[model samples]
Target: MNFDEQINKLIYDWEKHAMPVLRGVAGVNSLAAVALLIYRYGFFLTEEETADLFASFDLIFLIFGMVYLTRLLFQLDRWAFIKSTWLEGVLNLFIIIHGAVNYFFGVKLLLSLSLMFSDANPVLQYQHVLSCYLLLMVMTEVTKLSTHLSNLNIKPATTFIFSFLLLIGIGTSLLMLPASTVGPHSMKTLDALFTAVSASCVTGLAVVDTGQFFTFKGQLVILFLAQVGGIGIVSFATFFATFLSKGVGLKHQSIIQDFLSSEDLSSATQLLRRVIFLTLLIELVGTVGLFFSWSEELVFDSFGQKLFYSLFHSISAFCNAGFSLFPDGLNTSILSDDTTEFAISGMRIDIRRMYGLHMVVAALIIFGSMGFTTIEEVLSPSKIYDRVKKPWKDWRIGTKMALVSTALLLLLGTLAVFILEVDQLRHDKTIVEALITAFFQSVTTRTAGFNTMDFGSMKDSTIIIMMFLMFIGAAPGSTGGGIKCTTFYVLLLSAIGDIRGQKNIIIGRRAISPTVVRKAYSILMFATTYNVFAIFLLSITESGNTDIGILQIAFEQVSAFGTAGISMGITSDLSSWGKVIIIISMYIGRVGTLTLALALSSTVKTNSFRYPEEHVMIG
Candidate 1:
């Protein structure tokens, strides 16, 4: 053959055969690599003596998976190979393979790997734990890459995944340090991860007394986690660097869009920026208030304690974490004691101390659970100025609904708590203290579990009040949990609409979207199902403890599930099994039941081409 003909045939074969080989194998190779990761790392190192090995291996594997993912992508895209679907398929396949391996090998691995390394070196432990976190960041990248390859935006998912992984890593790092360092001998990575998750997810369940467990350094770590958690993972990440690092990629913008739930290009980044600004603004104001209130007792004390206290409580309150330096969650000493009538209440802090703490904490919790949209709508300088200029100017639908719903929830909560606890208040000094305790309890019930009054001896009616508030929770896109106040409002509005035979749910002259209604309903069902599942687990595991009742289990489970974290002093008494259940519940609650559902949800999309809608029987 002629030289020209030979060259032409060679080029055509390279394009058709070689390029296609890479594209198809992207799916296959990525899957295999991830599968190998599970069998080799996550499950195989379960013995206690192999703790360091397991830790080191898990750390290496996590980072390795991330690195390997990029390497695989590099091999595929050495050419301009841009098919993201095949990549996603491969990633999904790998995750599935890992899941299968975990179920098959997890128990054996835990028994084997954990036992081998229980007394491992602290430095090595730190190194191993840190590596796991870095690896998590890589995994997050993979998720982002896979989602980008899909048609949907995965920014929110990416921010969430990365932040969650980072939380575990930071918590582990904190717990591994000596008391001279970060202030703990050694905390379980999973437990620390749980605490970190609780702080980052802003759910307040603690296996250890956060006040007594960690040193100031450890407390600081929790504070940092709570800040990141309260702000939404993306907001914190974006604070340092937004999409502008390399001149703003479309994938980054899409991720931000998802995280903020903002479709407007102008406001996409604005939502994150606004959240950061609002968080700092609230924390700053809160710190000042707390410092002023706190400084009185240690009146001549140095600035350092006041500063640290200010920083800690501000984040705790704003995140709605309810983790306090004080042993008994909230001070009931001279503060506000809900159970001054109970002998156990004296072991709680003095009442006078709690009053200032209560008011500051209450204020912070109010802002934290109030929701960002509410902050922007109700407290935005521009909106306020505009309102001053024109009182009748319409506020955003989100703002209007948020205000009405929040007001109704708070008022109901306050009034109900007061009425139920008034008898207990009579033993206390004045109406002021009783009123403050009732009001503070009422406000925190919506999400934050901070109690001016003791939570343990409260009437069953108050617990019921708390349960209802927790179920309703904070507002949409807020720091707190539950189905979310906005969701509750929507469900109520939707019911009203249905009763009236209306086409759509309407509130404040604005019609709510069907998709939103469906999501709200989905969240409610998912939350209820999860709480039930956790309670079921607790019932089997904790039935032996006479002190712990099913009601307490239900309360603890819902508190964790709602990210509410109000315990009936039952958490510490729970079996490790029960603790594990609560940890899982807190993780799910904070990352969000929706996010977890989405994380575990089938990647398999339903057929885009739907069949005709069929009529169904109605109640």
Candidate 2:
């Protein structure tokens, strides 16, 4: 056989023979992983306690890491790990180093190594290294499991739903742990589940003040959930797996292409790589900006605390989760004393009163909500200069639609909100603050949930405006969730076409697909129906119990259905049944209304046979 044939044969042989053994190994590692995870997150363990607990089964991670490392070293014929990119190889190398140090040098070297990361807390370094090792093991096993699942011929959509359900379930369980909560009382299971759902759905709606009620471990759990859920669990797992093995298989690429809504399977791997890289890049930059914004605030207890605050908010913002470390979300100006104030340029400002911070956050939200495809079209490395110089040349219709719709929505939303709330804003704030807040509110209303002004205090007209904006949310395939700007845009074009007595809906001289328009209508109708149903349920469940009005209840339900999370200060007081309704709304909204609709549908029946069509009056 030639080189290609030989390589193919080798892969087949490995899969036919070696995979069984690897599967068994992965099964064992999964059990060990469970124990390790519990030990790490189940309780507040001291440095010595953590060390002792790790010592109990310390060899498990080491052995798995070494095995993968060996696969990289001696398996040149297999071209497994080495075939992965250099960055992945470097990461695996660190895993091997960690495993070696743990096996050979044990606690002594780990202590010395801990100094490299944190002098005051070497145990954190140890924990970080162990977490890395565990991650490597999990990724390998998960990759294998996914392959096996694909072999069993599971549908990608079904797998996607299951993966999210699994993440939410696990996150809920972890957040319910006693150590995850602060103070005397533990977090109720229902509340924990709600928070877990919100975080995993990247909805940012919470029953408790995240900074106050959730311990560091809990915050970390939420942060982890947001990241995984923002990108999607399957994409997140497979992206890391691609680094440890050969390129992603065609089947895997097909599934990921569907998940990301990419052009095709051919670009799925490259798209995933860019997605992960872009997410991290944007979050890192946001963190730096936030760090400077908060550095002058001096509210954090330590530099590490401030750094974590910045990092958490950055990730949360970019993920469009709307989670804030501040107790009142971003409305910290009213909640905290002047000590938390910061100097921007020359003027002193409260954390909540910082217009510059709001602008930075608004930028993150806009970029995040634009969707990766639109981002790639405009800002990808190859297109960056072309976009600036040529400006709209070669842009896709979707890109143009997204940009135009976003701008139009932002302008109108800002103008509407500013005009409606001018009296309220002008009472205490300057014109600049009022304008910035209006812009910020407009940017956030479409999806990102961070609120500078309290929604509870806003007028009903403003709330109605916000509800409308939230209903038509961020663009498709973005971290932000809703019916999607494209879906709404298509519906609008269809309406306009009907008014003009046109059959084919056209934009920019390009005819829109009939199928696409139909799908958009279906999505819009389904979303509206879902929101109405959810609102009815919440109204019945929370009526008379809450001090708030029906409008507020409807607002909250729409927010949940939109995955917007901009509540009118009634989320915490929601009845259990109401919470359940919101939870379902959040889940369906994040998963896509049509995705749930499809999953529930009997099957995709081909319309080979049809009865004679009869025109029916409508509108």
Q: Which runs in model 2 stand beyond 4 Å of their true positions?
A: 1-18, 46-49, 65-109, 115-124, 147-149, 295-298, 334-349, 386-392
Assess every candidate by TM-score.
0.71, 0.89
| Candidate 2 weakest lDDT stretch, 10 residues | 335-344
Give the Cα-based TM-score of candidate 1 against the true structure: 0.71
Question: Which number leads on TM-score?
Answer: 2
- C-alpha-based local distance difference test score of model 1: 0.67
Superposed Cα deviation of residue 470, candidate 1 (Å): 0.8
What local distance difference test score does each model get? 0.67, 0.79
**Worst 10 contiguous positions by lDDT, candidate 1:** 335-344
State how far residue 4 of model 1 sits from its true place (Å). Answer: 36
Indicate which candidate wins on lDDT.
Answer: 2
Report the lDDT tens digits of candidate 2 across residue range 518-583. 899999889998888888877788876849679999899888888888998899898889899999
